[model samples]
Target: MAVEFMHPDGLLQQSDYAPVAVGTGSRLMLLAGQAGVTPDFKPAAPDLAGQVHAALRNIIIGVRGAGGDVGDLARLTFYIVDWVPEKWDEVLAGIARAQQAEGLPAPTPPITIIGVQALFTPDFVVEIEATAVLD
Candidate 1:
């Protein structure tokens, strides 16, 4: 892997993800925001947790489609609608489940979560975009 994640001294080292990611791969993949909607254009899951899980899984699918894996991911940006601090645990849990199902280790990519008022569809609670580098 040409991507390295670092948590320098004096930086917060929470297990959720690394705060910094340096990638030196020759190929880069930029994925569009993946929503919770399924292939049939229907909601994959109705609840926030479910949408979060589906969106994460979709990100994995995108990475793999680009001939990359989770470890190749350098960054992730999550856009959430009506996001609430209280639901963070649920979101984390959904991410964990998606990672496990994909046979991926804990993500080390730099992650950013943004709260927004809405999305393309009224049912979409979350959307995620991923950037990956392939060696």
Candidate 2:
């Protein structure tokens, strides 16, 4: 498996994702956005940290269902309702727990966390998306 860093003439390398991700001879999986919302579309937890944890759990389930484990994950994007420097540690710890459950090694996937005003539901604190590449 291979991941290439690509940059075009007019794009900012750090902030912009590649226009296309090419993975030759490797299986690719695109997962849907997973939030803290339960099966009935209710928030699992009103608190930000709890919601983040729930969303990560949902992501793991989705990955397993797709025949790919967390170790196969190459990139993850997180969208949060409100982000502050004080919350970084909580976010990192949550991610570490998720990675550990999947038996992934250290130096986790490239992650992008974005802060937004709100999500589809007022109670939803975080939403996460994942991309996996399996050998």
Candidate 3:
């Protein structure tokens, strides 16, 4: 699969994230928002970094279950409770850890992050939803 990123004249260019992504593939899979929760609906980890990694793992499971790999992901959306600019460090750290553990490549998809006051419950801090494609 081939994915392209376009940066217009005025829009800012980010190294890891792009404002837009164009991809062509044979199949597309949309995954529901996944959080860091155990089957019994308990938090997988107490800290934000751990939660982020857990959520990333969930994302990989979802995509792979759908017959796709990390390279097939087209886009990602993240929701963070009580989000702050400083929290990006933790998020990046978690992503790095996940990439190392899972042997996943750099995130090539366009990603959007949103901040909210709460999620399904107070214990849940981060959730990720994704769209994936396979050629």
**Per-residue C-alpha lDDT of model 2 across residues 1-135, encoded as one tens digit per residue:** 444334467765543234334344278887887997788989987777667677878877887787766666667788987787688777766666655664443455566889999888788878999887766
Candidate 3 Cα deviation (angstroms), residue 108: 4.2
Q: What is the lDDT, from 0 to 100, of the residue 96 in candidate 2? A: 63
| Tens digits of lDDT, candidate 3, 31-100 | 9999977767788899888888888888888888887877777788989999999999898877777778
Output the lDDT of residue 34, model 1: 92
**Model 1 segments beyond 4 Å from truth?**
none
* C-alpha lDDT (0 to 100) for residue 30 of candidate 1: 91
- Which pairs of residues collide in model 3? none
Candidate with the larger lDDT of 1 and 2: 1
Which ranges in model 3 have alpha carbons more than 4 Å from their true place? 2-11
Highest TM-score against the true fold, candidate = 1
Q: Which prediction has the highest lDDT against the true structure? A: 1
Model 3 residue 58 lDDT score: 86
- lDDT tens digits, residues 20-118, model 1? 888899998999999977988788988877887788788888888888877888898989898788878878877877777765457547888899999
